[model samples]
Target chain A: MSLPGCYPLHDAIIAEKLTKYYGDFLAVDHISFQVRKSEIYGFLGPNGAGKTTTVRMLCGLTRISEGKAYIYGYDINRELVAIKKLIGVVQDISNLYMELSCYDNLMFCAEMYGVPRHQRKERVMDLLRFFGLEDKKHVKFKELSKGLKRRLAIAAALVHKPKLLFLDEPTIGLDVKSKRQIWNLICKLNEKGITIFLTTHNIYEAFRLCDRIAIINRGKIIAEGTPTELRKKVSGNKIIELQVSPPIKKSTILDNVDGIIDVNIGRDNTIYITINDAIAALEGILEIVKKLSLEIVMLNLRGADAEDVFIRLIDGTEKNIGSSTRR
Target chain B: MIDMLRLEDIIKAFYIAKKDIKEYYLKPPTISWGIVFPVAFTLAFILKGGHHAQEIIPGLIALALFFGTTSMAAASIVFERKIGSFERLLLFPVSYIGIALGKTLSSFMFGMVSLFATLVVVLPFILNIPTYSLFLVAVLILSALMFSAFGVFISFLIKDPTNTMMIFNSIRLPMIFLCGIFIPISSLPLPLRLIAFLLPLTYSVEATRFAINGNYDVVPPIESILLMLIITILLILLTSIKIRRTIP
Candidate 1:
């Protein structure tokens, strides 16, 4: 299916059938996506879904097994040095200098990027303040808490003010406060006109932070859209949950209901029904309950969100929704 | 622009050297290996007797320099790699050669400092020995450079720091025995002498002996210097290749 505006709008990154293989195992299958300039694009996937591998391939940290990708129109394989200068990568692991103090780590990164010496000190200090790590400047990286270490890693990556930032699971294994802080930092960075390509397994983070997201599963792009768009794709059906007083055994009675699409009965005697129209299917559901003489204690209707869309898509139950997926 | 790129690499190398020295140079393990071990080893030789000490003084100094530099260099690289900073270094725009040179230079400096300390401790014992100060300093610097390159090369080959030390001990202990450090190369049997010829430390020992005693074995002092220079270059080249491949 064609992606909306997939024609490359001064694209910061573009991948066409990008693939990777480790020995005989295919780690990443043919996957294609584009990230536009100043866009906050999220790569959402589960563990070992090839999200990290794809990010590495884009940043020139790992060799691509097949297909092509470009950063600012430069071929990823041939123009890596040029690409390296334009992008900053924060890997899944906090790969910073543990022996060096926070200040030294930022300074060293600045020097490596050829930041002018006159501006180096100022820039490092500014980053320390920006990340709220100014007081921890003298502390060795190993001595800091895990959240501070991650903040320092991100600070070091931005030492050169890269045009595009690739953050791989930036909020993984962090406290809620730290996660929220990092989320604000990400938004601030994007506001300064830097393109962000974030890979995350946290469904809420993707929904809250990303302007557009692509769901990947088993090394392929399963769905792609804004959170609202994705939620809408699963909106044709509504979910109704019922708590019954007397536990009903058989759900086959609702199979003949005209508008009921699917029925699931929980061990707690709660029946969940999915239908194209909740109002149209409610009478039929109530009729079955009446026949069984089971009292309906409570009824609730839940709206679809990104999480629901993601679960339905990954579970392979919403096959019709993904066939024409677009972002 | 080309000049700027070259200048940036030089600056980066210096930065790495400075960072390494600050982080690992004066740490307890470095001090123990660089200062304490050499002094203890030298004192052991001196306690054996005056005559034996006189004969082995130069060898002891060479041993000190070799072990001190190699250990510091290998340990630093392995530790950085273990802590995941080495992979971060690879993400920067610096050349592989710059990184190798930065590490080599720091290791070489550590070796030089250790050698000087060894000399200070050995000074009072000797009464009359021929002195060629300039040649001696030159030989010592070249030897340190060669060994530092060797250390970096070995660090790249071995991933784990503990395993690297194990392999380092196995390799360096044999080199000390086979090199002309304790015994002159000519005194060894044919096969053993052949092994001595192949070791870089052999050239360092022979050249140092010639400078101090006005006598040489195997190759002349000038040839030994040339061989050390060649080995240093070859090792540095090999280290650059290794860094590029391993990091990429």
Candidate 2:
């Protein structure tokens, strides 16, 4: 199945220093990465962090200003037809024809990708059933709910049975249940041997779905590794959870306590602190609480998570990139 | 590169055309712009001119086709861009030329259908002579092709839907008076006549006048058809180039 290319046959996507510029603004810096076959590779970044631009470049929706990219051993620029046949992209918006019925929408996609006429109907129906949208097949896309619209968009992308699926913010604005369902669907798609390239700002979604994650900021990829590897490499902060009877500001113990990286106030008077050395920071935190006459209702030590990693990275570059990049 | 001349690409173009007709031309906005706008303009001309309606009928029908093809065609693509659906079309395995042809084909079909539907009502009142059916059909097809390609070009150049309509109307509104749609081209001022000669619609209107009334005074029908075909090819080429700039 190798398409006569220099890139490894096992690699589904290989982007080498791909760049994009919008007028004078550098939207994507010299970025490079690879996605192996059937693995869910996540590009985790905040808004305007160039994740979407990178995906667009790789998909040939936007031209790469410099360098090269290959999809299943086909060059993105020279072999766009071959690359397009190998890929499907679910954009940020579920942008199927609003006037067409769900069944018609998928059928139109099947036609666009040149799915064989005899097999198109059956493929569309199978996708509808898989997405739990068979009952809404006859309904116009505009009449469907946001969740259904998103689901149909994904189904439409799969009509031609793409090998590498690009999902840009797959579950951006969804309820907890709908998001979880989409997460499960993503897992199912990956299990079906479809290589997934996911871009998201959601920490939990990235942690839950991605096999390996790349953290990007200011148009540059800062770090990339597996969930466990990311935690071990750059996500080395210790998390301390303390619920005080009297609520205190996040900055109240900043100067008084050393080794504390960042602090966030959670629900129910609980405070989550990301620190370098938990032993020294915890003693300093206890003394500060005693001096302030605030009772510690509950105190527990927790392992570092995606949030701690994100805050650690954001805080590390706060001086270089002015204003908080966290959203 | 995918060849636009390939059979597979042509089939894909037809697929895109079918989708566009079903997804855009059947909508309320398209129906209103494609048929009602031209009919209203025709009605106004008929009411104002009274007995002179016979002389202006051919031009009016040509004018209707001009507006019918351009207005909704531009609106459909620009609206797709606004809703982010047009980008989806670009992601498909179709060439830029194929995409332009598909959009032009859709608009051409809509223009022809809408014009004939309007003609059914108007022709009953004006049917007194043996009409040149085949020649008229040929003239209609060329005019539709020119306008449809022009509209597709406009869609590729302008990104916003409202702004596209504004630009189309700004050009189309003035064309009605300039292209001899209601007035006689021979009697127009020298400067205006020169301007009219520069417009593609002028030849189309003149050819329609010949096909409907057996008059070839302003311009010859053969020459008019030749000019229309040239303009259609040019517009489609320009549209494909303009749309390609979106990628790089």
Candidate 3:
């Protein structure tokens, strides 16, 4: 059966120019975005980049200073009750009651969300097993390792099966294996059509999990798009680094190198060339070295990634909002 | 509204409170406050005044109730803040009323346990009077709730646990001494009497004194109960408002 449009306007989440000020400082400047149904929208930024502040605004934990945020067609400030009912948040910290057992913690959350008495036990057990925490059901939260604690936090947050899940730096302090597992779980949840709003400084996690990403800096959103789109919009395909035995001296040799857009000289005598094609640029640089009788020590090539776009957006000289903004 | 507080939430609160109370007792200094100080003060004041042991017994009980309840409430806040449980609760569908009720009830329950244990130790030696017993009991429970709410309010206002204790001491110590918990409020000067009235325990201790000594002239039992009820309501209202705004 097709759902009716009259069934209330549900877009999962819409944050319109949401701004938050703490004293005189703007923690979240005028920023706006929307997460459609079943999309894992990644909020990408550096440490003090206001991503957490934006998440806090959407969850209604912090009041918005200027604009409005809505969840499931309900304005956060005006309809907080309805918004809170449909949303689940996994904050950076593990806020589970350390003294309570994992089963008890899940049950506590289920009960608070008003799951029926008979259904609570089944729901609690399902969530525990889903997170691979069934065996540690009776262990106190404090005794659990950091990764286990994060998993338990996720389990407790999902006990009510909310529609829009907000995960703020969910895998920040976890081990590599645990982080990969969490990434898989997040993807699984997204595949089940649960809209995920994630905020993190880990570019690789965002690349792996997010369907689309917004890069925030200082307090404003600088750029936003899918991972593939972001890589395409930012110039350059590969980064070529050349460490020479006797550092080649010349501003003109690099300036004349074709396909190399930017050259960065480091204090350690390593030359970093941002290029359109690594294969073409590497051949050209080698030809110049052969002609000049220059000695080559080490060469490294890496593909452009979100971290590249992020750095260019924040620290780069030129600023270009992606094509999506104009359209 | 009561349904808003889930059985699981209460259970969680209880578990946390139990662990907190254990940690509290395990600390070397808290043992002195829990066992040594109350007993020492009870004996020191009771013996110093000879037949005045009866006069000081009710006050000592009220003092114990205050110390036990407020300490638990403060510890609850410190632990919750440290664990970021307060932020977790704010993210949930639960209302501020639910959080406040859970916290208040948990601290009050733990406090009563401490008070009961202290009473058991002190009861066999006291005068064992039954004057205005219901009124005294009512005041004890009411003052405990009010002070616990106050502790929670103060907890949200400060960032550090040590700071919470410092602030609690600045506010609670004066109330203990001047609120007729250790002496008669009537004997206090006019300025101090106003300060005593600001404390919920003053009316509590006054009623307890009346219950124990049959001295119900200056303040009636009904008047004391009314005062406590009004103060308790206002404190809860103010605390709820404060806690709601302090969520961030």
Candidate 4:
């Protein structure tokens, strides 16, 4: 009854070969992913990659063209009303009522969700404080700063205490400090056992926060795994950077080098290489240096991280893992 | 059934509607549409009437109600759509019918409030008018509800505020002239009479006139009330269907 190494024992969110078409153009072409309860699941994709459309379908804002999604245990189509009651969404854009004050907006949402009058005020205050917008409770939504407005939207989404939460770029357009605050709040909410399904274009955010991520492009999921598994799959466990002189015909030399898979030319004639083992690769590069009498200005080694895997997958050079793989 | 009325969803709809209508009251242009324009039209007609002043009182009241309801519904939906507040409403637990009904009720209440103001403005002139106050109140309330639903139906068909106002004015001008809002139906020619009888306001005008003049016109007054009720029920049904289709 429990998923291994995750909070969502049962699938909190599930999409099976989901496809969406707008008129003739295929916006989403048979993508699928599962999000576990209490796990911060990141959906990473470029703009126009059908991430918003996918989230809308799961939230019941748009009908799926093919396949289906399930929230908690209910089908999105058949049990929409029940599913809607359980899930809450903070959209990329501000969906808060602008004319209303912070308290009024939350109160309106709470009333619509049928939260009892006796506890409504307490719930509003608690959510406001949680998002660090307690001081702006009396301010109109339009008057608040962009960060506070986003915080208000988060509070509005959680007003009903929905078990499943969807956050679509919660930190988009926010300053770095505001972005950190929102991320911290999101982490705290996940800690309280709320299942989070988030979509973002920020690679580092996904790498740092998500337990598992699905990389989508052109509506199809190109890759899916933990950050570590994905990095290891694309190149290896480490990255090696070597700065050398001009006339760098190291392509042939680097190709024959052991423990190295691929190399890319960095700025200032620096050569960055992906390797299976950092120490062995460094030793091989040292041997090549000694034999050729090559002078190395700088040599650095680091792990192959999510950014490496992402570029390779999108660059059309990654190995094929499944029949549905694009490149 | 009353318990159903007291459900949190229904109450929340009313709360939203009340908030929206109150905001409209605060806005100068919206206040003119909901209160000033309707009252102004009624006064213009009252001052223009000679011997037919008594006959025009109920007609002006119906006019006030019609303009008041249509303007508010059209304005509210267009404003919500413009600012993306409607999307927020869709996220709530409330059903589409609750929203339609709530907006309709608020429009109806606002129309009646404006009508009451118009009646007070015209009171000094109609000294000979009989006070069948209770019957008049009931008839006016029914007529207000009927037109409010009609307004909801109209609002859904429009997408732009400017175009909506243009369309509302185009339809309102002819109806104000042809629906016996400013003239007696009996005075109109036969073909126009048949056309006038088809409009919901024609029935409301007749019923309200009877309630005012104590005419007790045998067949027309009773038939008018029944026909208005029928039209209102049909409009509410249509609004419900349209709203349901819009949910996705």
Candidate 5:
């Protein structure tokens, strides 16, 4: 399917070869992508993959070493002030003032964003209620539980009702329940017409929440697509595992079988087979086993997921969409 | 839009200052370092002898202001930077000068508070110590502002809290010796006198001495005041530059 326009008119973010270098070391190699309006764009990468570096550049917290980026048509380098007004950032760590209570933290953020005094109280109260932090409004940020602290951090970022929100690992260290609550909050925020740029390493989080995901490795983007689209990158292959009384001594027995991609005989008399058409090849596989007089004990077939694609891309087994490897 | 931006900068700066004052300036450790230590040190001088006790008051006040402003500013900024909150401040729409000014003003106010506490503790005990109130207030304000700027400058230059405190102590302790705080600059050797001339605290102490005694032991009081003002402006400029380059 083709996008409607040459340039995405509804894009909230656009980067043109955005790059960053620390002295001689390149932290973010030239990488470019777009985030559409009102969509949750997930930025996934391994450690030291420049995911945080890219987000920091877009938010104007770090200077770009080369190339340029624009947030809602405002150049990040030249019009940072204008861009800052339209965006809110929740860093990986809770950056709220620990000494201040939850209410004061929100009020302070409101003040920073220049929310009028008359509306500041209402804005803060609304955020407290929205994040379900109203009961802990008077509690100091340091005294709040890890879950509450994360909630208050997100609440603080929303004090100004930013058009775009940059969330860096919002639910990184939260309990399962807390993580689910934040996911719901993120969904609710997006429902109200806010675009979200999220950077996370949690595959499930990205898979469940992001409208689109871009996987980056070693400062370069290796793949960009929806979760299902990425899964399809390796969908041509299927995994079939079989247990037999005696493992086949010659792995070449299935080499000539139609639709069989590869076969690996493992310890404990287990046979692993990769095939193109599992339904068509199942008979051939069983025929070989019967001829060898191997008793079939167990069998299982599995499909690929986002985690598999991620591993393949990062491990250099899958070629990048555009062959972006640098010499 | 420009007017609103300026207004927002001012408001954000105020919020940062308020938060810092509550979080750092009013804390027990800062209060003790700024107030209690200076009072105790000054009292030790008073108890030792009444002959030169009046002369030591200005030095004590200067000492309190120096430690009060520098320690609080350095500790606050280093702590914020270490915990990653300072980077969040950079994401706000405020300019670098606004952030520097906000921190400087809060530290300055804390310095003034410490100066006030020192005076309240010592003034009633001293007799016949002539005080020119106008010049005294001028000297106090200028010294606090200049030292606050110095504190902010040093904080921006160093990242670790321990290293900042060490540098501050090394610079301030040596300055106390060279600035004629405890002894007359004229009585020092020529080489030491040149060193005293290079120190900003020298002018602050001299101007303060003139404010209390109606005469300066070194250069004229007016010259010292003007020099202190010039140094304050320069320090503010240096602080702004450091913040701009180092923050992002």
Candidate 6:
């Protein structure tokens, strides 16, 4: 199928109630969203939140149990061949052939993507140079470092000149420097006019990389908006993070505290208390900790950001669904 | 089969096959396994068979091809599955059948080369006979393809490459004993001979015997060749369907 004129105008990805089931368990529940052209759309959620499953369905790696997805208006099920031409996927594992050299690996992808015979070599060399992998071109993939392998994996995906790229945890399991390097590449790729569909649990990554953020948890998109817009949605709210010794029950904090809108047990024995007024909420939290004989290790009062918005949306979604939807 | 014929997809499949050959089967150790194992097996059997060595050549040659094709055709894909490289192929534009066939092509080439290597070592002893190279070549080609497809079908039965290979060897070892690779079907009991006929290797070795020794009593050369083609087609279709289940 010809890919030149397949697009029905803008909107790079349109997923409507896209669902997936692994045997009897539901992995992705009817989640719908749209990714605008040349924009980075992120699915931000914690682990096992159906983010990877959604991305896999969009890339045609996994079958959709229900609902529909259209890539540039091309149906995923019926028009996958044409869709494959317009999209590239970089899975977290960097699943390129490990035994082949970096040059051979890119060359293989170029050939498989049906690049013109004459252009395969030049395109591969260009990618090697672009990714700063020219020196490592002859090195086998297994011999390269994790950061270099990730770069080569991204380079392989871009060899076909795909318009829409699906990055499933692009900076996953990378060191600080490697993660920043990947972040730069992502922005540079977006500047070159490629639409990116990124899924990550990294709050910093989503905050810095995405043009629009969708908060997905428990197989659904609870909230979707720009980073600033998402932050703005919760800006009226305030957060009091309490790092306490001998943590108390979240229910205890919620039950005794007045003016506390919500309480969640966070990682590392900390608690995130959402409130409208930080001063009044802090007094109530301190009283509860003192009564319980708990020592306050640290406390911080801050305005809501994307992470706060994420926790708020997830908390709201969990309460709205409640025990009836719990699996 | 029609879907496998698309020009671009077929070209992509060839490249996939090329990559597999380069990464897995073309290594010095692997090529040595393909070449040396057959020659060594032939020598061991010739010395053991003594006066019967002349008749054992055809069966050993068939055994060489069988081992060569089935081992790699299945191992390569399951290895990729373990290493996660096969996921890349699944995500590519190539059809499921194309990927399966690409694996088969690599194994088929390997089996053909093994057949040639076995023939080179044994050809001197058989040169005294009025051998038909065309018929022998035809039978070897079809058998290699059939054997390769058979391996592809079995690969879908397991996930881990190491376990898949273990199961493959367990099944292959039985087929070797049951097939006429060591014993003549004509000399075996009726039940054993019937089981041999049910196995693809029976026809492979019998047709080989007919081509090399001008003997055609147990099974006709053309019928054996035809059976190999039909079995190959059936297995290729089965393997393609099995490959599709990977997507879900």
The digit string of per-residue lDDT tens for model 3 on B113-195 reads 66786677666657765676776677678867776666666666777766766777787778777888666678888898878
Q: Report the candidate with higher DockQ, 3 versus 4.
A: 3
Q: Scoring model 4 with DockQ, what do you get?
A: 0.43
Cand. 3 Cα-lDDT: 0.74
Kindly report which residue stretches of model 3 are placed more than 4 angstroms away from their true locations once superposed.
A1-10, A235-238, A241-252, A265-270, A276-287, A294-303, A316-327, B1-40, B47-50
Model 4: per-residue lDDT, tens digit, A1-327?
112343244789878789888889898898878888789998888888888888988987777889977788677877666777898888898867667889988887888788888989999999988888888888888899999888889889999999988999889999999899898888998999999888998888888888898888888898899887777666544666677754365456777778776776644566767677777778888898888787888878776456666766765663212111112
| Ranking of models by TM-score | 1, 2, 5, 6, 3, 4
Q: Give the TM-score of candidate 4.
A: 0.86
**Share of reference contacts found in each model:** 0.53, 0.82, 0.57, 0.39, 0.65, 0.82
Q: Isolated chain A: TM-score per model?
A: 0.91, 0.88, 0.87, 0.87, 0.87, 0.82
Candidate 2 similarity to native, TM-score: 0.91
Instruction: Please rank every candidate by lDDT, starting with the best.
Output: 2, 1, 6, 5, 4, 3
Question: By descending DockQ, how would the candidates be arranged?
Answer: 2, 6, 5, 1, 3, 4
lDDT score, candidate 1, position A115: 89
DockQ class, candidate 1: medium
Clashing pairs in 3: B131-B211
Backbone clash pairs for candidate 2 read none
Where is the poorest 10-residue window by lDDT in model 3 chain B? B22-31
TM-score (chain B only), all candidates: 0.92, 0.93, 0.82, 0.88, 0.90, 0.90
Point to the candidate with the largest DockQ: 2
What does candidate 4's lDDT look like per residue over B1-248, in tens digits?
01123365578778767766644545555578868998887888788886777878877888888888877777777677676677667666666667777778878877877777887888887866555777777888889999888888888777676687788778777877777766667788889888787777787777887888876322277788788889987786677677656544
Model 1, span B1-248: residue lDDT tens: 11122666777888888888878887777788767888788777876857767667777777888888887887679888887777777778777777887888889988888887888888777656646768888888999998898888888888666687688878888887788777777889999999888888888887787777667778899999999999988877788788767733
Lowest summed lDDT window (length 10), candidate 4 chain A: A318-327
Q: Please, what's the RMSD in Å of model 6? A: 4.7
Deviation of model 1 at A92, angstroms: 1.4
Q: Individual DockQ of the candidates?
A: 0.55, 0.73, 0.45, 0.43, 0.67, 0.71
Residue-level lDDT for B164 in candidate 1? 72
Model 1: per-residue lDDT, tens digit, A1-327? Answer: 122354555888889999999888887899998898998999998899899999989987788889988888778877776777888999989978767899998998898888898999999999999999999989998899888888998999899999999999999999999999999999999999999999999999999999999999999999999989888878997777778877766667688887777777766667667778877688888887788887889988776656668877777685322221222
